[model samples]
Target: MLKYMLMIVFSTFLLCGCSYSEEKISTFEGQIDYVSGKQIKVDCSNTVAANSEESGDQVGVGYICFAAINGQTKLEDNNGNSLSINDFTIEDKIKIFLESPKNIGKSLESRKFTASKVILIKASPAPK
Candidate 1:
């Protein structure tokens, strides 16, 4: 009986520890240095938002709505971190490391990427 009780206690501790670590996943920050048909590049800051967008046509689990500048396109989150690969907006605020985009052909409205993280940086308003 004592052995079984000890096993249960250890298992519980392990499960709890795993959850705590998952919540502490590392986050990066950077400016949107570059963007192209296939990938994008963000300069790094510190804090970042994972999921935030204006709602899209095809919505589902792990799918966050985002609006690309031109072509009025939406992005799907097949990648690990949906927040990491959000659409880029010219006036968007972001903080992330440099990386390439996975899928290509995504429209960039006026050639500007959608904002990745809402928390990373505060996008300035467009000129009047």
Candidate 2:
């Protein structure tokens, strides 16, 4: 009984030590597509999907990343001026700094990650 319990605990620790995350901050520049209370959807790509038909743009290979904002996420302008989340709007160009998982035989861009910093590159022009 005790032997089995210790073995399980050790296995759990070992698994956690070899986590899939890369422990590195990765960044990508993109335009904001959707924004909610604490999460934002960013359009980060514009290429065509590999499996899409070559006739036209059947399936877009565009990558949209959903970033979850928190107190730690620093929202700033291009000049490093602090800003509020409300300042963000659709189509705004921004660069997001986030922690990415290790590229384990897959594209990490397809997964959502917590945004560490959001820097507004360019705000969409005011609507008429």
Runs in model 2 with CA error above 4 Å?
1-25, 46-60, 100-109
Total backbone clashes of candidate 2, pairs 3 or more residues apart or in separate chains? 0
lDDT of 1 by residue, 1-128 (tens): 99999999999999986652112222344445544554545432121122212234432222212223223222322232333334554545454321223221122221234533234355446568
Question: Candidate 2 — worst ten consecutive residues by lDDT sum?
Answer: 46-55
Report, for all candidates in order, the number of backbone clashes. Answer: 23, 0
Candidate models: Cα lDDT each: 0.37, 0.73
The most accurate candidate by lDDT is 2
99 Cα displacement, candidate 2 (Å): 3.4
Tell me the tens digit of each residue's lDDT in model 2 across 1-128.
99999999999999987764433337767799998869889875442133222334534445676788998899999999999999999999999887553221125455477888999999999999
